[model samples]
Target: MKRGDIIELIEDTTFYKKGKKAYFIGRSNFNPNKIEIVWVGEEQAYKDGDIDEFPARLFKQVEHGDR
Candidate 1:
């Protein structure tokens, strides 16, 4: 998806904490297939500056209705 989009972890659980919502920061500069995201919920495990990177295929853009 595009940058600034909200995405949800769907299939990839190895990196993401399943079901957590994240803000799409952007795709990896070194690899277009990967994306970077910042956790945005109350999950205390992820603190400030915490970021996650995963394959673009593993995330789905959150629809307006889903918000």
Candidate 2:
């Protein structure tokens, strides 16, 4: 997905539950191979700087009809 797109976590349980939504913030500075994202919605206790990075494979572009 492109930057600023609404992406969903497909298989991440460490920071967010599967199917959770986030804003794509592009590649990580620490590791270009990973994509950074800003968390959206509840469950903030696990958040770090409101930003986190993970592999693109763990996320999917949210479709218009998908919730």
Candidate 3:
């Protein structure tokens, strides 16, 4: 996906470790089912913990802004 694609997290629990869980980071340069992004900013947070990054596979591109 490009820089502005809205996405949601998919269930990629298998890829992550036991304690670490994948989360939905913001948009970045990515390829479908191959390349994904993980947000690494200090402000990043998921649930009650700090989520630095997540796999691009977790996200599904949202196409609402096009219309």
| TM-scores, each model vs. reference | 0.67, 0.68, 0.33
Task: Rank candidates by TM-score, best first.
Answer: 2, 1, 3
Candidate 2, residues 1-67, lDDT tens digits: the string is 6766788888858657899987787788888779987766633623545567788788888844223
Candidate 3's residue-wise lDDT over 1-67, tens digit each? 5543444555536554333322234443453344333432322443346433444555566543232
Candidate 1 ranges beyond 4 A from true positions: 15-17, 42-49, 63-67
TM-score of 3: 0.33
Error of 2 at 43 (Å): 12
Candidate 1, after superposition: displacement of residue 12 in Å? 4.5
lDDT of candidate 2 at residue 62, scale 0 to 100: 85
* C-alpha lDDT score of every prediction, in listed order: 0.72, 0.74, 0.42
lDDT of 1 by residue, 1-67 (tens): 5666778888748555666778787888888899987766733534656667778888788843232
Which of the numbered candidates is closest to the native, going by highest lDDT?
2
How good is model 2 by TM-score?
Answer: 0.68
- In model 2, the Cα lDDT at residue 50 comes to 59
Point out the worst 10-residue segment of candidate 3 by lDDT.
16-25
Model 2 poorest ten-residue lDDT run: 41-50
